[model samples]
Target chain A: MTIRKIDIFRTGLRTFFIQSLWNYESLLAYGIAFSILPILIKLYSKRDIIRKGREYLSYFNSQPYLAAFILGMLIKLEEDAVENSINNNSKISSVKASYMGPLAAMGDSFFWWCLKPATLIITIFLVMYFNDFSNALFLLSFFLIFFNAFHLYYRFGSISFGYKYGEDGLKFFQKFNMNLFQKVMFQITFFLLGISITMLVLKFPFPKLVENIEIFKHIEFQIFYGISVIFLFFIYKLKRSPLLLILTTLIIIFIFSFLKEKNLVFLRIN
Target chain B: MIFKVLLAGLISGLFQLDQTGAFQFMLSRSIISSTILGWVLGSIIGQPELGLRYGFLFGIFFDLIWLFRLPIGASTPPDYQIGSSVAISSLILGISFFNPKFIYIYVFICLVMGFVSGYIGAWFDVIIRRLNINISRMSRYYWNKGKFLKFKSLMLLGLFNSFVKAFLITIVFLFLILILNPILNFIFENIPGFIVEGFAIVIFFIPALGLIVVINHIIKESTWKVLGLGIVTGAIIFSYLKDFHVFGFLIILFFCIIIWVNVLKKEKV
Candidate 1:
């Protein structure tokens, strides 16, 4: 069964609608669409690639919600290759299959898992703090609109770029140095998470007093920060595994829990 | 419309319990609840405003109960059906009698119901996970197949789980409604003050665990320094401005952009 462009678009749209019904599980449907549609689309149009690409772009641009739905559906679509190969003995290139999983993971973890959640959390906090219910509604609307817009633009861009650049796009990403991007994002997220943790621990009744405090007044904050610093120092100086640091922190927390229970030297307050 | 709203609410109630295995964080959002409920109950009932208000308020109350991780088992303390029923009932009352004042009563009923529903849901989880060995076996078998059958089975399981949870919650809510006045009087007569404070402390700590996890993930040296800088900058801006939403985000974003542009640009040069 040869796959036409209309078939691809319709399949993508149907998958998107079905996935939207469930929310988080929608990503699985999305991943399926991206994988199967591309393979199917490739078989139909060998010559009019540019024209087909333009048509796809226009279709997506005209329907932002449809675009977002398709992008989300692509999340589960990549798994099709793995399932098909295992079940039907169909061959998918190791490189293609291997890269797609990590790429999906990166997209899922970074954008959906981290960024979206963090944004929503922050927005909720802001709304609650300010008592701006209308603003909260606005923020929710903004998220839906913004994400859909990006999904629409990027879905077309990725497929078109993939078709036009072919192996070059794949090779470019394979060889591309993401260390700088990784380092910057890592630092920013780390900093935000740290400050959030400290503030949460402090939970200071008076904002003025927290503001006046020259340094970390909350002992719990100081303890966690100090432990984090020690872990960081060890990583830099001794080149220890990150897992070691995580284990050490957990151990310290456990010990702290016991110490507080035992009343071992200024551990408990009131 | 009433039937659809009931179906959606029942599904939502069950979804909250995670009984359905069909968890969508977005659907659980207060805005989505309001929008969906408003759409369903608005046109037919001619009470869109009430639906919007109660749907959101009840949703948030539901979320809060889940967030607090209240220990209510065997005997229902608070639950979602109570909230949904109260909200829906009040909306019905207001529309039928043309009395908007009933909305306040609706809100209070919903709050109490939310507490009850959450407890019942938790209890249901404990009960089902213990007793439903066949469900677990089915879940595992389908999970391994990686086929359409697996997906279909999971979806069916989700639907069944949700239906069961909703039915259980509805029963609990109905039971509570029958004994509401007496229970309220008993609570007013009995529970200690210090216990309330202890509950408050537990609630405070629950949300902090999420922050702790995020913090624990960033224990690297360079990241720590950057974090320190970000906090100091955030604090300073917050001190001057009082509201630091945009400022805090921009400061962090700017710091990141500068570091990345300098490092990558230098390497390129």
Candidate 2:
């Protein structure tokens, strides 16, 4: 008997909720088991159902998006088991173990670290660039669509492709070179950050730096840029939380600006 | 106000679920979550643009602050979704009653509140995860007993728990904000102009902090060459073109896309 496309689609949909039961002990174990239950019920006899389902109850975790690939592979294995009357439980578990860690790592670096922040910086630049708030909303939608398109591709692709390729699906992912993708994304993010910072400085020049509007006009950019770098260094090197640094800076700025407003003798602002 | 609070709570519940429960769609992201919160609250009060602006601002700000933190495993990052919800809802609700001239004060306070609320929300998140262990166990027990219905219910129960947790938190935070709104208004109104101006300054510089935070994440010795080249190119372009320079923006954006396509082409090769 062939596993229908609708069954795969159903499994794909279920994969979205696979992490719904995420807990400290078994992590994604229950969710994973739940996701494959429908497929298991359809494929296995009642007597073998419990035994087959028990395999997924063990601790299992993976990047949520990549879980689809693992599930697809599991379904394919289950299908083969049903066809050949062979228990592939051990193979399924091993396959899951093999893919979960690496996929999680790649997904974290690529999806979370690279794709997300890269798109975010671009969206932010657009948001800041466009004065119209509706345009900002449009950009936000673009950010969502752009990010999720890759996500759903991996998800839908993983399920279908993993089923098609079975264990060899790993080779398909190997072709992508996620590290290079991450590097390129980081480069784009860095480039966009540079533009974003320049635009930010242009938008909100330091009040003190802009004190002399005529003479210090061009110099303000350089000074603000230097200040941003210094802040970046402190953020990078500081052992404490960056949130602390931000709060402290806010306090200091509050004091300075307040004193300047009050026209204090020593720390007075023109 | 009741309608707005209820709506905020509902979406906050869904967004919270989006973060960890049903769908990991980027809906829970600060950029989207906060904007949705802002838009909803803004529309309720007949101020869609105001909602979008502040929502977008808060989303961008919070997203930058927490951009580098990844949920690689069981680790929970600060819950920016709830934070933005509380913050944006409070701002929109607060602005509804207060003088618009004093909007800067509201933005400043709400931002700080949002930042603080994220940590609070995360604290709750850790507790929720801990509590979910019982649900997981029960679901397993039911599954083992061949009570698939009970097992499914337990699965949904976990999601429901997450939703209720988020909804209650949002409602509670918004309630506190509503109660304190008048007091906050009076206090800020009585405060001298200089202090308010200082907060305005802080708000202006806040984006710089966010920009630097993100830049720091990408800045490394290995990537500095590309980064430096980008900075130079960006600097030249920004210096020449002024605000809303769509033409110049498009050119640089186009160049970035070309490089991206080139990289993909190389990958295909």
Candidate 3:
């Protein structure tokens, strides 16, 4: 017998909860393990088991954490449907497992390690710049939860799509590559980093300017624009190392300090 | 369990030290174990800050050891909890012994202790793997015999391994701290300011390494080039709005969103 839609959803949720027990390392390992169930079933189970197992495995593969929490749930689901040996299949299960591993790695690297930290760092810097640690922490927590929630939603949606479309759905995603989403995310990250760095540089003391204008008056926005252009040039044309860039910035800061000390240049702000 | 924790801590610390190449000689000269060994003694004797400072400094030397990925020879020490506990306990004992000078002697001792702990943890891992294999076989046997207890056993075994590792490592370090407190305090007092500052810089850079890893992953040629542009643009906007209070960032964020949604959004499409 074929696996029902509801059964697949229930199993996916169950797998998610179970997989959550494992720590980061264990979760990755287990996700791979469970994803291969279809292959295992194909090899050992009879024809009917192969079919049903393939259907179930496809749904499991699409779930978040690559259905890390769903391994046990998938196993349990298989056990429940054991009587319907007609629908259980193995080949499909293996295929799902094989695909999900790479997908999980991509998700884990992009979302967990890179984007999340970048967002949090930018937010934290802004908060600190504003002298609002409380709100910063709040925003930090919010983003963390928000990201995780999105992960869950995507996992669930993917799995549901799998149940409805099977291998076809997986193929579609592979073909499309979520390019649009990625571009948007990259843009967001770029904007945040750009603004935060600009603020940081402007806040650096401009002794000469302070003397003439009421230091805070007339908003010398041009300096920020100029510095940003310089930063862009360094990042683009020089392809300089972050360490080098940081060192250069520090050296510039020191030079500025030395100049101020020597009275080489002064800005008199009204 | 406590012994295991102490052992893991020692192992992690030793691994950290071993990674330091020649720096191990310096740590060897200065008594280091007292700070970490203090944890096992159930008293906060060693300076937690100092252990981290030294641990970080010690970490720089051990960079070569990180290639193996085994905690045995890595520059990054195991968790800080292990060293901190040991250090604290040692300081307490040093004060009690009336020979605070003895505290410095513990550094070398702690390094040795860490090495032994690494070996112990490695041995335990091997044993756990063997047990897992045996259990899997046993489960298969039971399944062949129409018995289902193997599944339950597997779950229990997995839980046991994770707990054991975490628990044993914590315990071993705590024990080391208890025994070595006296010598640690004596050494802690004599460490030079410059050495401390050097170590501090090392600690500060560790997170930067983590950042590099993240950066490398993000800056692939195809996807992340625009990230540079966004940063440059945002910086320019920020420089202009510096005096406007927090509202500056908010306004910047708003403009960014618009640029993202409209300009970049169209290009991507």
Candidate 4:
């Protein structure tokens, strides 16, 4: 029996909960079953549904957004199982096991590492440039829409494509070349970040003495700020905790401010 | 005041549902959620501008600070939502309740508290995940007994648990803020002006650290040359162009170049 449009829609909607029941033992196994239940219910009787659901109870995990594609392919496989009695559980298990790691890597790199940061850098740029509340709000709305639009398109498209093309739907991932996309995103983000850093440094309230020094006047502050960022980046590369860095900075600032208050020699900035 | 606290709790609960329960539409993100919370608080107090300022300040800090912490797979990073929500709520509520003159002190204290609360929230998140082991087991039990409805209900139960966790954390923090307001007010009165100024300075510098983190993430071996070009471009824009109109056009031009490059790449492919 062909899965109806409404059932497909229902399955797509249920994919949202794929992480709702995430746990240690099964790690989205139940969620996978839960997401595909709409299709399973439409295709099987009560006994068959339980058996099919039981098949998914073993450990399974992947990037949450890409899980829909796997679910759709799984439904197609299940349909084939019902019609043609293809080799049952092992095939599904292997397909899932093989796909989850690569898809997780792709989703994490593309969505989490690349896109989120790019949008954020852009948001910071716009907000800093505009420096207005309403504009900030409008920019924030842009962030949400820009992000979710791409998210929803892939989310729904993956489901439909996987269902339609079965395993061959993976060509979508191959065709996109996520690594190139990531490299491109890095370029854009780095450019924006450069601007943002400069803006942030220019806006910083330097001490009058520091600001007045002829040699330190024009862009010395920006240079110092850039060097500090590189220093901090190295500390981060050393796997030092951000909390530790913040605490150290705070302590140093607190000491300097205190000494300056005490009329320390040549250190007054406020 | 009680109504505001309750409303904040409700908002926190609903916004956090987007964390894992539903769409993952990034409503749970600190910047957006804090802004929305700030807007709501502003509306409640009849000073929308002040609220937005508070929200924007705290939101940017949290967003930038936690930008590098990716929640990939099973790795549960610090739950920044609680930290940001708690910080913003405390700041707004402290201002409303105590009417402290040294607002920076309040903001500073609230930020530290919020940062601590984030680690606490993540600890609780681990607990909740562990407890969900029992939940999945119960689900299996029901599935074995042919109780599909009950099995589905477990997922809703999981969602509800998440909502309740966020709500309870916010409510508890609100109460803590209420109890500590007098102490904080007293300290605010007694604190040295320089110390407060130092905190304000530190607060301003925190974002620089966050920027460092983002820069570290993006500036791989392949991208540094592009980043160098960007810095040069930014320096030119900041120094040469005083008019926003020119700046706006340049910004648009940059986006056009990005799009053009993408199109060129696609066509070549």
For lDDT, the strongest prediction is: 2
Q: Score the docking of each candidate (DockQ).
A: 0.13, 0.52, 0.13, 0.50
Clashes of each: 21, 0, 99, 0
- Best candidate (score: DockQ): 2
- Deviation from native of the Cα of residue A23 in model 1, angstroms: 17
Per-residue lDDT tens digits for candidate 2, residues B42-100, read 88889887787778777877888787776657787877788788889888887767776
Interface root-mean-square deviation of model 4 in angstroms is: 3.9
TM-score of each: 0.47, 0.90, 0.51, 0.90
Off by over 4 Å in 2: A175-177, A204-229, A232-236, A259-270, B97-101, B257-269
What level of docking quality does candidate 2 show?
Answer: medium
Worst 10 residues of 1 chain B by lDDT: B196-205
> Which residue runs does candidate 3 get wrong by more than 4 Å?
A1-10, A17-64, A67-137, A171-177, A190-270, B1-134, B142-146, B149-153, B171-184, B193-209, B220-245, B262-269
Error of 2 at A21 (Å): 0.7
- Model 1 iRMSD vs. native: 12.8
> How far is B129's C-alpha from truth in model 1 (Å)?
14
| Candidate with more favorable, higher DockQ: 1 or 2 | 2
Model 1's alpha-carbon lDDT is: 0.41
Q: Give the alpha-carbon lDDT of every model.
A: 0.41, 0.76, 0.40, 0.74
Q: Model 2, A28-100: lDDT tens per residue?
A: 8888888888888888766677776668888898888888889999989999988998878789879988989
Name the lDDT value of residue A29 in candidate 4: 88
